[model samples]
Target: MKLKMHISKIKCINDLTIELPIERGLYAITGQNGSGKSTIVASASRVFFNLPMKEYFGDTVDGAMIEFELDGNKRSWHKKGKSWLQKQTGSMNIRGFYEGSLIYGYRFKDTTYEKLKKSESIDKAKLRPSHEFIRKNLGLILQGDEDYYEKLYEVPREYAKFDSSIFFYEKNGIQVSQFHMSTGENLLLSILNSLYIKNKERKNASKQCIIFLDEIELALHPSSLKRLVAFLEDMARQYDYAIYFSTHSIELISGIKPDNIFYIERYNDGTIGVNNPCYPAYATKFLYDHSGYDNVLLVEDDLAKSIVTRILRKEKLLNSRLVHVLPCGGFRNIIKLADDVTRNNLLGKRASICIIVDKDVKEQAIKYKKENGLASSCGMNFLPIESLEKYLRMSLVYNVDQKLFKRLSDYVFQQRSLQELIAEYRKLKEFDTDKNGKVLYSLLDTELRNRRTDRAELIDLIVEYLFEENKQPIQDIKKFLHKELE
Candidate 1:
């Protein structure tokens, strides 16, 4: 059975709704920090598992409602409450209604004291949140040593204990009940758990299950993340399970299929807006048409996907409408993807294509470019992940706006690491940090205030300048050759 969720009147969200595919695969929920990404997950947990809404979210006047479909029938839950005065004046009512049937309803007066008085009474609660139930069934793995190597001799119903159980590892060490493990160990354990736990469930279940992971990119090395994605995709197909994970990592976005991709954005009012890449008619067509092409633009791992798409559209070399600007987690994946494209004929006629990789990946980019025929031809363009830095060092150094370019140039010279550069940028007046803490976005008001030229036009001019002075245009070179000779 697939679960669909529609929420209304929740905290920081007025009318937020999203339908999740319960197909046995991964579902990724990603957005800027505090964009209510976690809220969606929390709300779903509350409705599905029958938990106290007040426990997760503090007091609120507006009641929340969730509607979901179960077993081909629609069901809805509504929670209404007034603020309690002195822990005695108000009540919270939970009503479950399904297909004209009033399944259940309960009212709790003075919940604060009631919760404190009977905190151990689990039976009083009508529905347990799905997350809590899963955790309980699976056994809670806390942030320490007890969680690591913790084995369950008996399997919970709807869940089976595997020889290799799900474990959480951190940078410090394996979080065994009380002891911590090394980052490498933690990463290895996470990879193992991600696959092993899912596999075990698939082996035991009569029906397929879905695995949802939040911020899956955390603590994972790029190579490991890539391997995990590939493994997850295969496992989903083999076991008839679906896997969905959210990440701020661009590398994962570009490497995966567009049909499986979903974007979450936050509105000013605190509600989240979901953009499913598969749902968009045009995007769906594009993905279906170009499933194998590897010659792709790989932008910075931390860059906002919207900005990258806008930049590509401005260049006019490729229309963002048709060409997908995939975020390949980072420079490492860019190289990996490019190499894969060249060696594998997955793209057919579109096989030999160029990828815009970061200059920071100089060694790998150059080596790959030299080794492959596709990489040799205008198929590779290495530039710094920072456009300002690239503009300052490469040709047309003076053509760019002096102040903006100089600021980035100075930053590049002063900051030795990308992390340090981003950190310093955040300290500057113009740059603002997004929820993810990884993307440092320039304030549009501040950026435009000092700029005289249209930024998009300036970018195009820069591209034109590079093409004229640095190398021949690939399109022109293609036109000069006659395919009839072949």
Candidate 2:
């Protein structure tokens, strides 16, 4: 059911690889604007038809290659100049079924309905299936509204310039043409009509159907969007269909399984990256939803969060779906938050919360806990080292290989010899936390801002060194938080 795709040298997407479910499931590819979500959909759509490369990538594209696997065979589509070449399967069945499966709501603009209105020919028979589909599905979305079911009539159509002139019935059975419908209603009708029409036209030519709907949430009311999502879920299951939605709807993305959601981002290096099984909080930039997680590990900063996450992953104790490592302000705030959660049972008995701070803050955390009469079950823990920066510095001196050390020095210190830089860094007053003096963590953060080099990547190298040089400290933290696994 897993379909792996790799697209390289194409438009804004330099190189991107993603995995999608090809069998039967609803999947979403979402991200901020210009992250290549639509481009990915276009690439996948090209597999089914001979689309012009110029349509998507404009006039200039250094040769592009898109590869995917179908039935244990690797198939590729290559684009050079203005034309596309395909790895021929010799049979037209798969392509034939998929060619009619793409639906773009934007394809139906106000002008389109205007054209439909002037057409003279009427085709009541061809409109029956899609009209019935919209009536039944729309009724579900408008469940409490009597008007939707009692007054709305089956869409009637007259064959038009493009395809058909669609009409809707309102209260008193009054006829309203497609041009008169609200944008949300028009969008919904266009989507369902296209889907039903395509499926009907295919007529079970293939056992599985793949649909790519771009910007599916365009102009839909939030309530209608939710119901449409549920309706599509049912449709996906009823018929063996793999439906792909390229959208920006948080409501739509949040409801999907983490593995089925793909988050796309264009990094500073101008290459597209796709994070499959992306967390909903990450995709929407709304971190408050911890409803599905069983445990939350509160840390002082993102670096600490990365360190804890890396350790848990290294020990095989991390399941991202269940555990959330959240960076919650400073040391004082994290301690206070943990104490409050424990004393008030904020997360209830079913969820576990743990506080982890740097080793340097252990004394202060202990003092605060005693002053507030914090419970022992508050689960206070500390990193093995004084701070992540100090630990990373130590690792650079002793643990890392020449290649990695050089890379780290080049990125963080701006090509300054790390030994000299570390000596100077140690001499500064309040070097660990001073903002004016350019704290080591702040320097690393600047690298992130300037180059999009994530702190997580730096943490990966540091944790890799920790796993080899010292792993017991990580094991101890994992042991203290074992209630999460329960």
lDDT of 1 by residue, 85-122 (tens): 11111222111111100111111212244443333222
- Return the lDDT, model 1, position 430: 44
Query: Each candidate: what lDDT?
Result: 0.44, 0.65
Alpha-carbon shift of residue 189 in model 2 (angstroms): 1.2
lDDT of 2 by residue, 88-165 (tens): 543322432222113332244234444655532344344333355666666666453423644444434334445433
CA lDDT of 325 in candidate 2? 87
Candidate 2 scores a C-alpha RMSD against the true structure in Å of 16.8
Clashes of 1: 38
Model 1: per-residue Cα lDDT at residue 184:
40
Q: Candidate 2 versus the native: TM-score? A: 0.55
